[model samples]
Target chain A: MAFLELDQLSAFYGKAQALHNVSLSVASGEIIAIVGANGAGKSTLLDSIMGLTRVTGQIRLEEKSLIGLSAAGIVRSGVGYAPERFNLFPYMTVRDNLLVGAYTARNNVSDNIAVVHKLFPRLQERANQETSTQSGGERQMVSLGRALMTSPRLLLVDEPTIGLAPKVCNEIAVALKRMRDELGATIVITEQNANFAMTLAERLYVLESGVVKAEGTVDELRNDERLTAAYFGH
Target chain B: MLQIIVQGLLLSGLYALIAMGFTLIFSVGRVLNLAYGAYLLIGGYIYFTVSQTLGVPKVLGLLLAAMVGCLVGLLKYRLLVKPLKGNHVAVEISTLILAVVVQAGVVFIYGDSSKILLPIVPGVTQVAGASVTYNLLAATIGSWAILFALYWFVRKTHVGRAMQAVSMDTKGAAISGVDPDRINMFTWGLSGMLGATAGVFFASYTQLSPSMWVAPLIIAVAVVIVGGIGSIIGTLIVAHIIGFMEVLAVAVIAPELRGVFTMLLIIGVLVIRPQGLFGREEL
Candidate 1:
């Protein structure tokens, strides 16, 4: 069995459905990407996994059910999610933001913070600065660093490259690779940037209006005409 | 002028205590707990029952009041807040009604007439030619001490940082593995204890009556409005502003005009900067 499994998952916001009958499996230590346009249910899938939204169907982590757990409970179960909106507490200093992320794994805070600071050294330099005053790329770094502070085994990062310069995006890609290679964290990223996704992800899933349209290894998915045109910028 | 300054400082300390609990709920829980004033009412009555009627030690009575207040806060969250499902308007209206119900309950037990509480510390001293009651002085000292302690707790503690996280963004806090529900629960209880402690001092400052909750509620609202919601330093600074304004109005202007300036100040701030002096504009 895969380390994490989602079977026939359907998610809703109020009465409106955002995802329909979506299923995926993820093995340990593998990096996967879900690429889609805005409002194509990419973030919702991550939200469903994080237990941030109402869902029907099964989400199992290590064969244990995660359907009814709260978001905090899901995080405690060793999943860290960096949302697209960069939800770093605006008024809090970057250091405090990182500290709060270790709420579930309080004992390993110093070690986790050290790892995050190493991954994103800019965060350490601006540790005392409030997040509100930070630039867009810096804020994204804080979001990713804060997620790393949770010391999660499975990390879900949504739209990490959005609104960022290519240089910062490369920096993030390198950090994510280090997190996977050195820290042994299994990463699942959702991206609108298909080229960026293909660079880091071992496998790719293309989502269109809440359903997975095509999925395969990056080389195999490149052969599909529609995906090549829409996502690969053909 | 000396008397006004002295009186204003003492009064400002008490006002800071009174408004602190309300501000905490507003900031952390994102709810306007209209029944916050009822906490003071319950505290005063509880202290009166234990200390005056039952002849218990004053300190014990104060502690009992705080304990009861904490229990009431927990109950309010579990019963009223949770069931309401965070519809802030409904919670606000329900709490307002709850305050009225509590007032009626107080009237049923204590009767309509106001009661004068004996001073916690007896005697008066002249401070730079100004007459100062030892009781008010002690209350002021205690209030400042509690406020300082609270400041430390919020800034330097894990749970307090969690509270700040929840206040900023509930979803983000939860994503960080900080349970917003638990934080909200703890905040309500702590706010209750603060309110109850402030109640004892406030009642001693004035007189205990069924209608006593109204003035504090108004004062809390005024402080929150002018200072900015959810800011401790803002609350303290604005408390001093209003306290001094009231004292000056009473001493120099007319006593009847004491509250008029506070009301005008609120209106002026609202008109000039609606987000308040320190508050960030909602995103």
Candidate 2:
């Protein structure tokens, strides 16, 4: 069995369906990316995994199912989400934000904090600064570092590079790679920037209108003519 | 002059204490707890019953009152708040009705007659040519101690930071593994404890009556409105402003005009800058 598996997952917002019959799987400690256009249900997929939205699916994390668990319970079971909107507690200090993130972890929270700080040295410098006062790039580091504080076996991130400069985007890319390499946690990321997604992820799934339109290794997807037309609108 | 200053300081401290619980629930749950005053009423009565009737030690009575307030707060959250799912209008109406029913319950148990609470600390002391009751002085001291502790708790502790997180962004807090539900419940309980403890002091300052909840509730609403919704230090500052205004009004102007200026201040602030003197996010 795969380390993390989603079998026939569907999601709804009130009467409207957001995601339909989505299936994906990830091996232990591998990096996966979901690329899609606007309103293609990338956020809904991550929310479903985090149990923020109502979902009808089998989300098997190793041997256990994450179907009925609350968001906090999902975190306890070792799944973390970094949303597209960089939802840091704006009033709280940087260190406090990370400290709040590790509330579910019983012990060695300071150690986890130290690890995230090492990954994001900018966060360490602005440890006492309010998150809202920070720049977009620093806030992004704070949001992602906060998720890392939970020490999840699997991490899901959505659009961390939106509205950021390319240089800052590259910095985030390097940090994420270092996270996978150093932390040894499986990661699933969603992005609207197909170029950025292709560069970061080992295997890529092209999502279109809440369904997996095409999925393959980076080389296979890069060579596809349909992907260029569908994704880049060429 | 000294009388106004001394009295204003004491009364402002009590106002801050009473407003603490109300501000907390409003900040965290974003609901107006109309039954908040009932926590004070219950607190005062509980202390009366324990210390006076049962003849328990005063310290134990205060502790018991705080405990009862906490219990009532938790029950309110579980039964009233969580069930309604924080529909603001519904929670407000339900809590208002709950307050009246609780007041009636207080009347039924303790009788409609207002009771004089024996001062927690008896004897009067002369300060700055003004005769100050030890009870009011003790209340002020206790209020300061509690407020300082609460400030430290919110700024320093783990659960407190989680509360700050939830207040700022419930969804964000949850994604970070902080359960908003649990934090809301705890906040409600803490609010109750603070309200009830303040009630014990306030009851002694005035007298124990079921109707006593109204004035303090008005004060709390005023603090929340003018001081901004979520800032504790804002609450303290506005509490003093109202307290001094009332004291000065009574001393300098007609006694009946004590509440008039407070009303005017509330209207003026609401009209001009409803977000409060302090910014909204600085709690």
Candidate 3:
């Protein structure tokens, strides 16, 4: 049985349909990447799963259906989503931001933070500094660390390397891979960086204009010339 | 001169207590509960009815007043705030109307006459040629205790931290598995309790009247506007600033122009720096 599965997922913002009948499944400890251009419904798919948008579909995590749950509720049921904007508390310290993520794990806050810091040590180094003063790359780490503090079994990450340097992007990818290897977290990443996404994921879902255009192993998708031409078309 | 300092310190403590409730509602919920003043009025009347009218114990009366205030705050959230939801203007206007309506209701029952309340702890002590009532001293002590406790709770406790989280970013806090709604509800209740507690002392200091709420309400607003929104330490500091300004005006300058300086300070501060003196970081 798949650890995280989406069945015919559809979402709408006003009259505009943001996602249309999107479906995918991922087993535990697996990494999947969704690649698309801007406005290609990449972020919308992750938002739909996190219950941030008006979604109609079955999102099951470890056999439990996650439709109609609130964002807070979905998060409590071991689901995490980190967007490019990161949504960190600028007024709070890095430590407090992570604690807010571990709100459900009241007794295990310090332990969860320890695991997160081990995954990304920069967070521990800047634990006491106000998040507003941190650099963009460091804030990205904070966003990622905050998501991990929940001890999530399934994580949806949207455009984690949007404006970061290549080295930082590689670090992000490595950290995400570590999240999968160490925490046994199933990751579904959405990105516009097709090349990097291709290298990172074992499987790929190619999206265009709110629809899944192709789905296959990275090697198969990389070999398809027609899909590649259409995927990055201006 | 000595009188001004003594009066300022004592009055500032009470002012901080009053502003704390108003600040909590503004911070966590982000909507100014315009009827916040009415909480003080209602709390005062409740204490009066329980302790003075019925001749019950003062401590029990205080407790009952706080509980009633808590209930009123919760009801306001469910009935007015929750129903209106995203429309901040509607909530503010509705609460203003509710405050007026409540004042009228109080007039209907208690009459328009102001009644002097006996001190909760009667007697006075002289310090440096300045007279200090034991009642005001108790209020100051109580205010300090409440402020300390609140600071500790927000800094240390899990639920309190959730309140802090909601104040910062509601959506982020929600996604982080903190229930913004529940935390908001709790904040409203706590705000009410604090407002009511402050009300009891305020009434004893001045006198009980339906229109008595306006003064404290203005002070609460001034604390936030002058000090900055969502900063607990800022609230405390600005409460003192306003308290001393008012005291100094009455003593050194003119009693008639006491409020005039405060108005000038508001205009100057707002025109100069709108965010506040301490800025918007939550204490």
Native contacts present in candidate 2, fraction: 0.90
lDDT of 3 by residue, B61-175 (tens): 9999999999899999999999998899999999999999989999999999999889999999987889999999899999999999999999777788788888888877877
Supply every candidate's count of residue pairs whose N, Cα or C atoms clash at under 3 angstroms. Answer: 0, 0, 0
DockQ of 1: 0.68
Position A36, candidate 1: lDDT: 81
What is the overall TM-score of model 1 with all chains considered together? 0.97
**Which digits, one per residue and each the tens of the lDDT, describe model 3 over residues A16-85?**
8989999999988889998888898998998888888998878899889988888889998998878778
How do the residues B40-143 of candidate 1 rate in per-residue lDDT, one tens digit apiece?
99999999999988999999999999999888998898899878966989999999999999999999999989999888888999988899999999989999
Candidate 1 residue pairs in clash (backbone atoms < 3 Å): none
Which 10 successive residues of model 2 chain B have the least lDDT summed?
Answer: B274-283
Docking class of predicted structure 2: high
DockQ for each numbered candidate:
0.68, 0.84, 0.75
TM-scores for every candidate against the unseen true structure: 0.97, 0.97, 0.96
Candidate 1 residue-wise lDDT, A128-156, digit = tens: 99999998899988998888888899999
TM-score (second chain) of model 3: 0.97
lDDT of 2 by residue, A1-234 (tens): 798899999999998889999999899988889888888899999999999888887899996999998899999999888888878888888988888888888486988988887888888889999988899998889989989888898999999799899999999998898888998889999998888988999988888778887889989998776566556564
Q: Over the full model, what C-alpha lDDT does candidate 2 score relative to the true structure?
A: 0.90
